[model samples]
Target: MNDYLVKAVAYQNQIRAYAVNSTATVAEAQRRHAAKPTATDALGRSMTAGVILGAMLKGEEKVSVKINGGGPLGTIMVDSNAKGEVRGYVSHPQTEMEINEVGKAVGMNGLLTVSKDVGLMHPFVGQIPLISGEIGEDYTSYLSKSEQTASAVGVDVLVNSDSTVKAAGGFIIQLMPGADEEVLNIIKDRMKVIAPLSSMISEGSTPEQLLEHVLGSENVTVLESMPVRFQCQCSVDRITNAIISLGSEEIQDMIETDGHAEANCHFCNEFYYFDTEHLQALKEVAL
Candidate 1:
């Protein structure tokens, strides 16, 4: 099934929740970054969480999720927007580790911080101790502690030892205005019983299905569904603009030695080549 996300109101609008089926999108990231099993699972969970958060914004507003795990996986950077576009990269995608007791990747020993920069609004920032070095708990901690919104977030990523994406997906549930005690209890109970996110997504369940299970079929109303993908907004022209920022010295060096410059974008791994003529053209343009 195509990767997609859904926004919903559950328990008669007492709660606001979002869920997503991001297997294909996460798989694309795993392949592009060549992430190992543990790294793949870690990065996939981050991307899934990022995608759902992105769906909560308005036009031109975006959220950037950064996890400086300080692990072999290094840092994970995700830039997502309201349009269901998500672009992310791991500082070290090739890292891996043996499965732990839960059959999940081990070695998270790191903190988590997510900074959401929405255009001109001073950029909302949230930080929390990395509860599990797993993406979801960190996000849950971030929301409950930093954002002051009681929330439950579950993210699951399954990766094969061969560096292949087995399954990946997640959901975020937030208590809305006037959320009652009973609603919270119902949500907690459902969250406790929900299946591993990967198992559901891998079985071809949509975001709606996941939410239905979490909120109970009778108490949920699906609002909107949008396609989500691994998207990057980097181009040769953007790279050229960045090169111009380097000033004349760097430009001259490239023109003199390599005759051209090549930059590999971290998000999409797309390389932008700046030939001598292109550099010269950029040099003449006014800042």
Candidate 2:
């Protein structure tokens, strides 16, 4: 199914919820980055949650999530926009480990930082130490510490034997300021019995269905839904402009030495190749 996310409120608007089925989106990232099973799980979960978090913002806002856990995956970076577009990459895409070793594959010794570009002179930056190296709890901790909001975040990814992602998705439920103890207790009780997020997605649950499972069909009122996809804002023109900014001398050196230049986007792994003629043209426009 095409990936999408849903936003809702439950129990008379006492709780705010966001759920997503990001299987195809994560699979795209895995294919672009060539991430192994463990790395795919980590990157997929992060990207899944990141897109939901982006949806929480208003117009023109964007978010960047960085996870550096001191493991083989190194640093994992994901960028998302309020429009439900997201792109991500891991430093060590080939890293793999046992299913039970998810935390070990993404070490718990570093930090998970989130920076938001909310149309301000200065962007908001919040970070928390890796509490579990599991993407879900870490995001839960981030919201608790950074936004001072009580939240439950469950993100997961299931990989097939050949290292392809079979399913990827997650849900985030937050208690609004006026939420009561009764509503809280009800949600807490229901959460304990809900199926795992990845398993639910694997079973063909839509984003709305995921929320229904977590927040109850009777109580959930779907507010909005949007399609989500793997999107990167990198292009040959952008790369060419960057090369031009490096000055004519540098451009001339590239033309004389290599006869061609290649730029790879870290986010989507797209390659931009510039032949000597392209470099010469850029050199003419350089300062």
Candidate 3:
């Protein structure tokens, strides 16, 4: 199924929940980046979290999660917006490790740091140390410390030995201000039978379906639903601007020595080539 997410409120507007099944979405990243099992798991969870958080924003506003885990995977970056668009990449996509006791990839290290930068009246940045290299723990840490809210986040990704994603997705639940004791107790009770989140997503279930299972169908209300996918905003023009930014000297060097320069986007790895003539033209503009 195509990857999509849903946003809604439950428990009579006492809880905010987000759910998404990103099997195909994460699969695309795995295929494109050729990520190893552990890297695939990390990237998949971060992107899933990016989509859920992206749903919380409004038009032209978005959030970015940068995880510098200082592992073999290096940095994992995710970009997402309220419109349900998100893109991400890991610095090194090919790194393998053993699965943990709960079938979660233990990754290169247990250390991670997830940070969020929001564009508000004044841009704000918040960060938290990851409790588990498993992204959900890191995100949960971010919300509790940075946003100062009680949140439960679960992200799951199952990869076959061949490195294809078997399932990928996650859920985020936030307790609103003045949440009562009954609500907390209800959530704890429901957590008992929810199963691994990605498994439900892989079974061709929708985000709404997952939430209905978690919060009881009677109390669920869909506020909005959107079709989201693995999207990248990079383009040839952006690469061109980057090339131009290198100043005239660099452009001249490429024109004289290499005949042309090929630029690869870090996000998509799509190659952009500037032939010698194009380089000379850009240099003239720089002059």
Candidate 4:
């Protein structure tokens, strides 16, 4: 099934929730980056959470998530917009490690930074120390401490034996203002008994069903559903503009030394090559 996310409210709007099925979305990232199992897990989890956070915004707002866990996986970065488009990469995509527990491969040190661009003069940025290198817990911590919202986050990715992604998805549940203690206790109790996130995704659970699994089908009031996917913002034109911005002298240096220039996007791994002739045109434009 194609990936999608669902937004919902339950218990009379006191609880707001977001859930996403990101299997195909993550599989594309794994294929693009040639990520090993551990690296795929880290990247997949971050992208899942990032996309859900993106849905919380409106219009052209965007969100970027950066995680540096002081582990072999290095840094994992994901960008998403309110439209449900998301793209991400891991610094060391080929790193392989054994995972005996939830946060083992991601490590327990470093920070999770979230930056939001809301068409403001400066984007709002929040940084928090990683409580657990597990992507979900780190996001939960960020929301509670940085955003000051009481939230529960669950993100998981299952990797196949051949390093392909089997399933990837997550959910975010937050208590809105005026939420009662009774409602909070019920949600906490339900979460304790819900099936593991990976198992739910592997069973072909939809985003709405995932939320229902945690929030109860009777209580959930589905709000909106939107398709989500792996979408990179990089393009040939953007790369060319970046090269031109280097100035005429730099373009001349490229032409004289290498006779050509090539650029690769870190997010999508797409290559952009400019021959010597193209470089000369860009040099004229720069001048």
**Comparing 3 and 4 on lDDT, the stronger one:** 4
lDDT of 1 by residue, 117-202 (tens): 67775987777667667678788888889888889898888776677877788899999867886777778797887787788877
TM-score of each: 0.91, 0.96, 0.90, 0.97
A best-first ranking of the candidates according to their TM-score comes to: 4, 2, 1, 3
Ranking by lDDT: 4, 2, 1, 3
Where does the lowest 10-residue lDDT sum fall in candidate 4? 98-107
lDDT of each: 0.80, 0.90, 0.78, 0.92
Per-residue lDDT over 182-232 for candidate 3, one digit per residue giving the tens place of the 0 to 100 score: 785687578777888877876776888888878889988888778778888
RMSD of each: 2.3, 1.3, 2.6, 1.2
Clashing pairs in 1: none
lDDT of 3 at 131: 64
Model 2, 140-198: lDDT tens digits are 99998998998889898998888788999998999999788577667768878988878
Model 1 scores a TM of 0.91
Q: List the residue pairs that clash in candidate 4.
A: none
lDDT, model 2: 0.90
